[model samples]
Target: MTTFTVNGRTHQPEGPSEMPLLWYLRDLAGLTGTKYGCGLGICGSCTVLVDGQAARACLLHVGELEGRAITTIEGLSADGMHPVQLAWRALNVAQCGYCQTGQIMQAAALLAATPKPTDAEIDAAMSGNLCRCGTYPRIRAAIKLAAEGGEA
Candidate 1:
């Protein structure tokens, strides 16, 4: 069994170690908010925080994440009101909305790592997460707003 912390709670993964964390979270754990897109690390749809760092769930095997703290979008805010979430909402960041969860989680991780990220830093950090609907400007604005403690 692999023991880890998810959303501030400890979890024991009983599935195969090679199982991707995305499957464990959605298939076994039922945390569906973490979206599925490219299924590759290329898209950030599966982005989650592994030990407070941005990680791609679709590619991160459960065995690799053992004993680590994983934070999904659900863990970002039980109240649905994290600064990033609020910013996303205020900016109307999603068109398809399928990738927003991962996008926000990635942005949250970025903000956590760098409270005040420059435009280049934000772009550099967010480069991996592809937005099909092209909401890049809004996402950038939201991250900046959230970083400044503003309500989007």
Candidate 2:
């Protein structure tokens, strides 16, 4: 059995070792905040924090997650007030809202690594995440706002 932690809770998932982390998270663990888009991993919709770094959940297998810590959007904050989340809310970053969770998770990872990122850095980091709603401007603004610790 592969043992891992999700949102501070431990789990030993029962399934094929090749089962994708996204399926386990959404179907079994009931954490639907992590989205599934472009199963080929081209899109960042399945983004989640693996060992505090952003990773594509759809590309990860349960067997490789033994002893790893995974954090989905639901675990981002108990009060929905993580700086990234607050920034997202304050700036109204979502339009369709389908890609927001992945965007937020990716931004959180970026902020965790680089508290203050330049436009180039932001572009480079966020390049993998696609927003069909074309909210790129607002997304960048919110990331900057979060870095500055500003909300609303």
Candidate 3:
């Protein structure tokens, strides 16, 4: 049994250790907010917080996650009001909405590390997350707004 903490709860996920953390999160834990996009780690749809750092869930194996703390989008806030989520809502950042969870999670991590990131820094931090709807401008604005203490 591989023991790990996700969303502040302990879990002994069933299955092979090689199974991607994404599957364990979605299938085993029933946290579907983390998405599966390219599955090659090219798109950031499967991003999550591992020990408060952004990581690609699809690429991380459950075997390697023992004793780690994992936080999916669902864990961000009980009321869907994490600062990034709030900023996302307040700024109307979602388009098709498929990639917004990962985008918001990544933004939350970025703001956690650098509360006052520059535009270039935002681009650098978020360059990996792809949004097919072309919502880059809105995303940048929301990050700035979140940094400025905006909330939902």
On residues 1-152, what C-alpha lDDT tens digit does candidate 1 reach at each position?
77898999988888689999999999999999998888888989999999999999999988887789999999999999999999898888899898999999999999999999999999999999999999999999999999998884
Model 1: how far residue 118 lies from native, Å: 0.8
- lDDT order of candidates, top first: 2, 3, 1
Stretches of candidate 2 off by over 4 Å are none
Off by over 4 Å in 3: none
Most lDDT-accurate candidate: 2
**lDDT (tens digit, per residue) of candidate 2 on 39-130:** 98888999999999999999999999999999999998989999999989898899999988999999999999999999999999999999
The TM-scores of all predictions, comma-separated, are 0.97, 0.99, 0.97
Ranked by TM-score, top first:
2, 3, 1
- Model 1, residue 83: C-alpha shift (Å): 0.7
lDDT of each: 0.92, 0.95, 0.93
Q: Give the lDDT of residue 10 in candidate 1.
A: 86
Candidate 3 per-residue lDDT over residues 1-152, each given as its tens digit: 88899999999877799999999889888999999999999799999999999999999999998899999999989999777888899888999999988998899999999999999999999999999999999999999999999654
Candidate 3: C-alpha lDDT: 0.93
Clashing pairs in 2: none
